[model samples]
Target: MEIAVVTGGVAEIERDAGQGSSMEAEWLALLAALRLARRQGLADFVLLGDAAAVVAQANGAVRAPGAMAAHLSAFFVLASDGPAPRVRHIKRTQNLAGIALARGR
Candidate 1:
């Protein structure tokens, strides 16, 4: 099975927004990685996030359980046979591309 690593990067705003969480951006970033892999016809892939929470969410960790949990669980089950992909976590320093994308630089 072909494996792809979907990685994300994170940065703190020196000038804090203080209200809206940047989680949406991170979420979009995860989607971006997933989309890229899909475009390449790669079904088996892993998602790596800067934070452990993101990784666990993608990998179906047992914390903060919700619809995402159920979705990921189901996705993994189906993908296991239908070109399964894996999701994991990586440090921000390790995700250079994602960092750049996040920074919009």
Candidate 2:
């Protein structure tokens, strides 16, 4: 899982690969950000992810599957008005904290 906390152009990203396993851990991070952004009433924010799910969810064009599907389904219950969160695919080297977190997890 990877997280990029940003207020403006500046952001600090934290990441970890849980069990040092598959990339699914990264998806969890995206899910966490989606949940957080929705809770924060964020009409717009920047998100970093290696998967397309972040972009798809923000655009309301794709739905999460498996265990994450349920939470993602509930998340959209709120009004996600305004532009969707900006999603940029970042390299692992740029997502330090996220990489670390995924590993730790």
Candidate 3:
């Protein structure tokens, strides 16, 4: 899987994700981006992704399935370490990270 991060409309990180289900990959990408933001000392930022289910689960709008429960928990724990996390769902075309990944392919 391909994972990418874009900040301020610029590509900040891109990487190949190891083997996992699509849901797991989405969670991994979100986690990776949050970790990077924390390292950069960012206190306020919004995370945008094309995965609607992951975003909904992250925002507590829905409950994650059993396989994704741990990931949802981990996201909350990591997000609590800094400012409140704002995760939003966007169309694939509106996601820069998705665009970048497409270009890489």
Candidate 4:
């Protein structure tokens, strides 16, 4: 899987998701993005993704599957360190990270 983080229409992070299912890759991407934001000391930011289920899980709108529970927990722990970033779902066409990954392909 290809994962990417885009800021200001530029790719800030991009790499291959070594080995995982699509769902796992999505969670990994989100975790990586949050880690980057925290490292950069970003206080206010929103994470946008095309994965609705993942977004819902992150926002507490729906329960994550058992397979993803650990990922959900890790996400919460990282988010709790500072201002929790909002995770929102957007259309695939509007997802910059997705677009970046597509372009790279």
Top TM-score: which candidate number? Answer: 4
Which regions of candidate 1 fall more than 4 Å away from where they truly are? 1-20, 63-82, 102-105
Model 4 TM-score?
0.92
**Candidate 2's TM-score:** 0.47
All candidates: TM-score: 0.54, 0.47, 0.90, 0.92
lDDT of 2 by residue, 1-105 (tens): 344544333344555434432335545566566666766677767767655664566456776667656545544543244445566677666764445444555
lDDT of each: 0.51, 0.55, 0.86, 0.87
Error of 3 at 19 (Å): 0.9
Give me the runs in candidate 2 sitting further than 4 Å from their true place. Answer: 1-21, 51-83, 102-105
Please give the RMSD to the true structure for each candidate, in Å: 8.2, 5.2, 1.5, 1.3
Off by over 4 Å in 3: 12-15
Residue clash pairs of candidate 3: none
Q: CA lDDT of 39 in candidate 1?
A: 63
The model with the greater lDDT, 1 or 4, is: 4
